[model samples]
Structures are given as structure tokens and as C-alpha cells.
Target chain A: MFHIYCPYCEEHREEEEFHPKGQAHIARPEEPEACSDEEWGDYLFFRDNPRGIHHELWVHAVGCRKFFNITRHTVSYAILETYKMGELPRFTAEFPEGSLSEKVTTEAEAMSRQEGVKA
Target chain B: MSNLVAQNIRTFETHPGVEISAESPLVFFHQRSGAPAPCTESRVALRERALLGHLILRGGAIVLDEAVHSVLGFGLPAYPNALSRDEGGERSIQWLSPDEWLLIVPGGEEFGLEGKLREALGDAHYAIVNVSGGQTLLELEGEAARELLMKSTPYDVHPDNFPVGKGVTTVFAKANLILRRPTETRWELVLRRSFADYLYRWILDAGEAYAIGVEV
Candidate 1:
């Protein structure tokens, strides 16, 4: 049983409270009618199955019921970091050192979590 | 923003008139499975505070806070997983998420309160849902209440981790409910109407060793 940290709830909750929603950062085409058959098909059916650092969407279904992102290592099955939606992750495929970074969140960064929401 | 959006939404009383009898979700279960009366030797006590007004408030915290404070006389819980209560302790606002809070008030006050809140919030983008009929609040009080919870849930319920005013929605047995510590010796369980019977039985079974008693 893994203790997954929910970004919105700001606490580590039991993994049973969450549901993993496949891949993260899948953007829908702005003009689906203008897309080619292959482009539309790729958008609808294609997904990356990376072996290393992977970012996925997950929802704290039982707790907060909010969707967030999780950066995890497929091989190690170690969660790198959990961040709110619309926030750029510090751990990515290019740079995956988030687990070692200080957990300190500055006031500015903390305040920025609601950048997309109506304040 | 006053009076702008009130007409856009239709609100009504949830309490079916006084003529029609309203039975709690557990009425049938309690009848079928009689509860053990509390005795001096009982170490755990379970009581249901049924049919209370439950509202799910969603919006920007600041906007909701001002309106809630004005209407309910208490602001929303400042931090996630925290529970804030009014002076009487009968009314509480629990922080469910960054943008959402759960307001539980005494029964029959929800309809009027919702209207007042809607009027106060005016045109602000927000949502207030009446969930009183959808859930029931069960309170556990006694020395072995913690032990009973420990046996049921994996969440840490130790005093150091779950002090008074801390509430969390987590897995308990095979179901999930909002578990909160309102006082030093009491813990509250907000169970969905559908899960109440199952969880009630589970709690009784898990608390059997403690000789849990039901306070009607």
C-alpha cells in the first residue's frame, strides 16, 4: 500500500483514495474538424509507455476529489513529486531530481498554486 | 453582486412536509439489527446525529470565507483537512479541498441558510449543494473509540497525528467516509446515505471487542 501525497489536500493519503488517470498533459486539438485522419486518430488513441520518469494524472477520489499530476519512476515505482494541475513539474523526463529537492515551498510558490483558479 | 443570480437557480425545502414521515437512512437497519444498549462496562459509544443540514460549498476560499462568516458567523477552515466550528459546536465548516468546504449545521436550518448565502454571494461564481438527505453523521465517543478506528482504517488516528479539529475522508473497512475529530474524546463520521448501513454494521463488528454501545 503506497501513501500518495495529494497536492490539493496538502497531505499524504492512502493510495486507495486516489485513482490513476493514465497520462498527463494530453491537450485536445483546438480545431478537431481541421485535423487529418491520422492526427485525429493519434490524438484519440496514442499514448507513451515510457520506462523511466513518467508523469500521470490522478484524482483524490475519496478525499478531495481533485485532479493533479504525479511524477513517478516506472522501474523504481517511486513517486517523485505530486503537484497541482497547471503547475510546471520540477521533475521531468529531462531532469528527475525532485525526490531529493527540499520540500520547502516559498510563499510566492504557494500563492501561485491558485493561478488558474478564480481568487 | 446581491440578487443577481438568485432567480437563475431554483431552491426548495428538502424536508418533505411535516405530514409525510421522514425516516433516517438507518431506521430500517436499526429495526432489523437491534443495537446493544450502553452499559457501565461499555467502552465505546456510537450515536447518529441524523438529518442534519449538509452543504458542499465550492468557490474561491476568500470569497466564500467572507460570505460564510457573515452567514454562519464562522469562516471556512483555513487549512486543508482542518475543521472549524462555531461556538456552540453544532455548526462546522470543514475544509474538503483548496476550493471546496463542507458546512454542516443543525437540522432544518439549511434551506434558509442557503438562501441567505446565495443572496450574500450574489453574482460570485460559486455553488452550494444541499446534501443533507444524501448523508448522515455518526459520532463515536468513548475511550476505545480510537482503538475501534485503528482496527478499521489504515489512516493514522494517533493523538499526535489526528488531534482535535482534524478531519479527513479516507478508507475505512471497504467504504470511505469523512472522519473527523471534533473534540478530545469524540470522533465524527460523515457517511453517505448509501453506505451508512454497511458501515454501521462494519463499525459494530470491528468494535465488538470493545463492547460498543449504541445511544439512540
Candidate 2:
């Protein structure tokens, strides 16, 4: 079983301790009033079911009880990244050292960027 | 007018196996004579009351360090998984997390001690919640207590890892408990109110082979 990382618990718990929440990187429409019906439909229902390197969200509902995103290989089940509820996932060639998504920056900066989002 | 004489008598039967003790901040249950105990009881191999005070302190440790040093005569422990004992060695405060602390004073003095801490803090962004009622303390003594805990929890409870004076919030037998060691022979389990009976029954079942006894 895959070991999922719980950001709140700050530990990699057994897969049994987590539950799949939904797709990640869901950006809210900046102006819903100005958007088309197709755009609204895409926002509401459309999601990527990618074969490899899919970034999906999961919740540590049984452990720390927090939501986080996981960049995992669907076939191999190898997780590339596990980020906190609101932070953006960074996948750059320069940062070749695959990190455990530690919050390496200031808390204030992270909090301000995610002001309207509910964690 | 002739008044009719009537006698009102109320009779109810309390089950002998379902013995509930007086309400304390915490309570424990254990069965005797190898008899089938109630479901609420943990059926633990052994159980006893841990007669110590427990208090939850919340605030920035850096800010509250000074007050704790002045009033308790010892600053907060620096280590994350450690506890600081007082001069008498009877009182201690364990760092539950970065922002939370579990303070244990002498039994029967926690309420007044909390008031003293409030006075000492003096409007700091801090909170001291009395959680004694929500939990009961179970003192697991005797030689096999350590082994029993190892079976109950996943954490390594060996003396090397869990030395005396250390406390940790860990899972124990399908439930959560704050485990602590006050002395060399004593181990404490801070169990929740709702799960006390379940845990108690589990303990009785586990400790049966060891010939563990129940204290009240």
C-alpha cells in the first residue's frame, strides 16, 4: 500500500489513514458573471485523467484530518510531491532533488496568497 | 371529609456488574473474580487511578517561558518530545506540541494552580483549559506494565525511548491516550471519558494472563 504524507501530522502514514478527496489545482473563476456556459461547465465537471504524473488531491481524513495534493504516477503509484492544502505544486528541472514538500518559506507569504481559499 | 392515606415507594434495580464510581475529572473500571464485565469497561489486564493533576496550557512557548520559569521555578523544556520536572520531582510539564503543553501538578491542586498560572500570565495570548473531566488517568504499575503498553500502542515505549518524565500523545488499542511516565515504576494513560470503559475492558483482557488486579 502507498504511504501518504499528512501535512498536518508531518508524517507519512499508511494509505489506510487517508481518503481520496478530488482533483487538485481547481482555480475559481475570477469573474463568474462574465464567463461562458462552456467555461462554467468545464470548471464544474471537466478534470484530467492523465496516465502519468497526475496531480490529484487527497485528504488525511483519518489521521491529521487535513487535505493535500499528491503528484503521483497512476501506474507505478510513485508520489512525486505532496503539498499542503493551498500551496502551489512546483515541478521544475532545476529543482531535481525531489523534496517532501516541506513548507520552506515564510508562513505569512503562504497565508496571504491563500487568503480566500478554505483549507 | 375523610382523607385517604397513600404510601409512595419507588424501587429500581441497579445491575451489579454495571458499577459506576463517583464522578472525578477521570474514572476507571476493572472487573474482579474473572467475571464477565460490562462492555463499557476496557477489560484491561490491570488498571489503577493515577492520582496526579493534569492541565492543558496553550500559548507561544517562547512568550510563556518566562512566566513558567518564574511561577513553576522551571522554564519550559527545550526538547520537543520531553517533559520538565519540578524541584520536588512530583510536578512536571510536558511539551505536547509547539503550541501546547500538558502540565501535571499534585492531585487536588490543579484548579488553584490554574488560577495561579492565569494570574501570572496576565493577559498574554494564552489559554489554560481544564480537561480533567474529559479524561481519566490510569496508572499502569508492576513489571509487565511496559509490555502491556507495547501491545497497546505502536510507539516504542522502551526506557531508552520513553524515559521517565516524558509524555506523548499516541494511539492505544483503537483509541487515543496521552501516555506518560512519572516514576521508574509508574506509567500513566490519560484516557478520554467516552472511551474509558472500552479501554478499561481492553486492559482487563490484556492483563488477564499477568494476574493483574483492579483497584476499585
Those runs of model 1 whose alpha carbons end farther than 4 Å from true positions after fitting are A98-119, B1-6
lDDT of 2 by residue, B1-216 (tens): 011111222212211233753454323233223434223333333454554566888899877788778778898878665778888876778777657788777666776666667667766788777765566677777777887887777766889877887776766788767788888988877777887778877776777766666654
Error of 1 at B208 (Å): 1.2
Native contact recovery (fnat) for each candidate is 0.89, 0.00
How do the residues A94-118 of candidate 2 rate in per-residue lDDT, one tens digit apiece? 3435434465444425765767443
Give DockQ per model, in order.
Answer: 0.78, 0.16
